[model samples]
Target: MKLTILGCYSATPRILTNPTSQVLEMRGNMFLIDCGEGTQVQLRKHKIKFSRIKHIFISHLHGDHFFGLVGLVSTFRLLGREADLHIYGPKGIKEIITLQMKLADSWTNYNLIFHELTSNDSELIYEDDKVEVYTIPLEHRVYTNGFLFKEKEGNRKLDINAVEEANIDVAYYRKLTQGFDVVNENGETIKNEDVTKDAVKPKSYAFCSDTMYKEDIVPLIENVDVLYHESTFLETQSHLAPKTKHSTAKEAASIAKKANAGTLLLGHYSTRYKDVNCFKEEAKEVFQAVELTQDGKVFEF
Candidate 1:
């Protein structure tokens, strides 16, 4: 799995920073997490193929999170994109984008499918053979949701030597890998466990941004391989966190520590502090594995 940070700052864009946006590539899927202003430009900067982004996920109706969506939809049309695009966002996203297209008369030529989420509880929003995505309801000023992407458990691996010793036919190898016992060429019952090894552990990523210190989310993101939580402020300025419905670096770390996440990625910085290392330091006080996110940065796991 790989994550490319297009933007990670909070609220507004700046000369050196951008708003919230990112591209996550996993299990043969490229997912756009958000579309802040200049997202396409960032995509170009990273040399990510725009055509590969079939699914776009918006956290909320915040302009900083989704204002560039309409422009990107139009750009897809301009490029004569033929592939259908799927968009998942909070309720009113469809209306927000459709109204802009209505006023500009710039509807996408390709199919634009919208999945509007309205549930207060977490729900599976997208799934395929290899991956499943679930919504992580968040506490924000407006209705918001984070996303949890989990790779589907893989099939068992075949022990070639064990299978060969068992005199299993080549055709039965597939069955062994699928965790099924099969009759060998010699009419022997071959146990799957005897000829197959365990599959690789699947990876998981949880994106939780624009939310306050929400402990209920710990269960939803338990044991995630990577947790990207918003650190819009430092512990020193924690007073502003509740006021703005945002989380401090320490609070985000607490969530990560509670979730037992492998790594904690801090982003959506308030941009008030000139040094981003302070966020990492504060988070490290609570969780050791912490990384500060910046535009144009890439992380692979």
Candidate 2:
């Protein structure tokens, strides 16, 4: 899995960073996590194919998180893309988007599907043969949900030498890769363990932003391979953090520690602090594997 941070500044844009947007690439597809302002331009600058982004997951209705959505959709229309697009967001998002489309008298020439989320509990919103997406309810100023993207386990590796030694037929290759026993032409059984190994462990990523300290969501993203959590403030400004329904670096690390995440990538830094090392130091107090996200930096897992 690959994560490209398009914007990382909090509250407002900075000379160095934009707002809050991230592109997650997996399974030969791009899944946009947030569409902050200038997202389309970031997509272009990063050389990511816009048409490959069929699924979009919005964390909340906050302007910093979704302001670039309409522009992106319009750009797709202008580009003459006809593929179906799936958007998963809060309940009011579809209405806002459709209203924009109605007022402009411009409609996308493709299938647009909206999955509105209203529940406060964790729920599966998308699933396919290769990946699954779930909502992680978060404590924020408004209704908010973090998204968990998980890639399914791959098929078992085939032992070609073992298969050849066993005189395995080509017709049984598929079954062997699926960890299924193969029946020989002579009515003999070839157990899957004899010619195949366990499947590769699946990878998972979790995105949490614009939320306060919430521990209930830990289980939903427990043991995630990578966790991107909002760290809008350092420990010294922790009081201001929760007062604004945001989290400090220490709080973000606590969640990562409880969830046992492999690595914690912190972003959404407030402009008050010129340096970001304070955040890294504070979070490291609880979680050892901590990293700061810079705009345009790509993290691979």
Candidate 3:
């Protein structure tokens, strides 16, 4: 799996960084996490094909999280895209989008499916053969959710020595990879365990944005391979974090520490600070594996 950070700045924009958008590429599919303003331009800059992104997940109603959605949809139409687009967002998003379409008198020629989220509890929102997406209920100013993407376990490994010794037919290799035992023409039962090793453990990534420090998420994102959490402030400005329903670098690090994530990606930095070194320094004090999220940076797991 590959994750490209399109934007990373917090409430305001900066000369270098954009807003809060990310693209996750998995199994030849691109899944967009957020669509802040200028997302399409960033996608172009990264050489990402917009048509490959059929699924989009909006974290909340915050403008910084989804303000670029309508523009992107319109751009897709202008580009003559005919594939269906699936969007998962908070309730009322469908109304807001269709209202704009009605006012402009421009409707999409392709299918647009909206999955409005009204439930406060976490739920499985999307799934396919290779990947699965789950909602992570979050604490924030507005109703919000984080998303967890997990890659499914791979097929079992073939034990060449055991297969040759057992005289397993090549025609049954596919079934063996599926963990099935087969009988040979000689009337011998070939055990799956003898011919196949264990499957590789799958990797998982989690995205958490625009939320206050909430520990309940530890269980939901426990031991994730890669975790991206919003860190809008440094330890010196921790008082401003909870008041604005945002998180400081230290707070984000604490969550990562408790969740035992393999790597912690810190993003959504406030523009008030001229430098971002403070965020990295503070977070590293708590979680040694923390790293800053830079626009256009690709993380592979």
Cα lDDT listed for each candidate = 0.94, 0.91, 0.92
Instruction: Compute the lDDT of residue 41 as modeled in candidate 2.
Output: 92
lDDT of 1 by residue, 86-146 (tens): 9999989999889989999888889999999999899999999999999999999999999
TM-score per candidate, chains pooled: 0.96, 0.97, 0.95
37-106 per-residue lDDT for model 2 (tens digits)? 8899989999999999999999899998999999999999999999999999999999999999999999
Candidate 1's C-alpha runs over 4 A off are none
Specify the poorest-scoring 10-residue window by lDDT in model 1: 169-178
As for model 2, its CA RMSD to the true structure in angstroms is 1.2
User: Model 2: residues >4 Å from true position, as ranges?
Assistant: 185-187
For candidate 2, the per-residue lDDT at 87 reads 95
On the 0 to 100 scale, the lDDT of residue 218 in model 3 is 98
lDDT of 3 by residue, 189-255 (tens): 9889988999878888999998999999999999999999999988898899889999999999999
Q: List candidate 3 stretches off by more than 4 Å.
A: 159-166
On the 0 to 100 scale, the lDDT of residue 264 in model 1 is: 97
